[model samples]
Target: MTISTEMLWLIIGCAIVTWLPRILPFIFVRALTLPDVVLRWLGYIPVCILSALVFESLLDTSGPIVSFHWSKVLTFVPTLAVALLTKSLSLTVITGVVVMALVRFML
Candidate 1:
């Protein structure tokens, strides 16, 4: 298949649009030195986001009452343990994946 002129420009435009936001922050922030308090506060952002995502997936709120997904809760126990004990992001992710696979297999 041949690429059309319009399609090529469209692709380039999309690439610029997608790349600018991700790159602009670093470029702008590189020159400025953030204070210790702001840096410390920024550190908690990832943890807060991850916790929100995990908790959202672990509970079912479709009905009037909230309910726990037992399989996810079971998987979370070991994953949380691994995260706390190892303090390794990779190990925690691996533990969560393996435990989730096992839970799905057994159930």
Candidate 2:
């Protein structure tokens, strides 16, 4: 595929736009020593984000009453246990994927 000058510039512009927002925050934050309160609060961000993502995935939003998939709930049990017992991201993810795959297959 031949890319024209305009397409190349468009690609460059998009890259800069995407990269700046992600990188700029780290660049600014890295230099400053955040206070203990801020640091403690920042720690909750990942768990909050993860919970949001998991709930969004497990719930069927057809009617907006928050219908949850039983299979996902079942899958979450072992995954959460693995996360708590092992305290490992990789193992937890692997367990989740395997459990979900098995649950889907069985269903």
Candidate 3:
């Protein structure tokens, strides 16, 4: 089947987008050696970023204020505690959802 020009452009775009990030890390990492501490910290980057984003998103009951709506606070506190205590993603999420739902429905 003959592909249209749009399809060709899309394929090229996908290839470039996929390659850019992959090539960048290789180029930069090879050009300069990162410190051991930097590398160690880099490992936690995804976790740190995810935690900050989740906390930021969840904290807003009605904008960014220190308000305890109970459900949101209940949900996230146990969630983070379980995650840190158990170091298990599945347990953390399951516990959080269950607690949140129970609190919401119960109250």
Candidate 4:
């Protein structure tokens, strides 16, 4: 396959468009001092987003009634325990993945 100049420029443009929004905020915020309340609230954003994602995956809401995904719930038990016990993100993720793999393998 041959690459066209127009397609190359398009790719470069797309890269800049995708990168600007992510990089611009940090560049602009570097010099500014955010208020303590704002900083505290920002810290909760990651936890809230993570919780939302985890809970969404754990429950099945496609039908009329919401139901729990037993396999995920089973995986979650050890994962949550590891997270609380170690307070290590890397270890918690490893535990979750390994536990889920085992659950899938067993069932």
Over 4 Å off, model 4: 1-18, 64-66
How far residue 56's Cα lies from its native spot in candidate 1, in Å, is 3.9
* Order of the predicted models by lDDT, top scorer first: 4, 1, 2, 3
Per-residue lDDT of 3 in model 4 = 98
What local distance difference test score does each model get?
A: 0.95, 0.94, 0.85, 0.95
Each candidate: RMSD:
4.4, 3.7, 5.5, 3.9
TM-score of 4: 0.62
lDDT of 4 at 101: 95
Candidate 2: where is the Cα deviation over 4 Å? 1-17, 30-37
| Clash pairs detected, candidate 1 | none
Could you tell me how far off, in angstroms, the CA of residue 90 lies in candidate 1 after the best superposition? 4.3
Cα deviation at 105, candidate 1, in Å, is 1.6
Give, for candidate 2, the lowest lDDT window spanning 10 residues.
Answer: 57-66
Q: After superposition, how far is residue 12 of candidate 2 from its true place, in Å?
A: 7.0
- Measured on C-alpha atoms, candidate 1 has an lDDT of 0.95
lDDT of 3 at 87: 100
Q: Give candidate 1's error at residue 34 in angstroms.
A: 4.3
Model 3 residue 105 lDDT score = 95
TM-score of each: 0.58, 0.64, 0.52, 0.62
Query: Candidates sorted by TM-score, descending order?
Result: 2, 4, 1, 3
lDDT of 3: 0.85
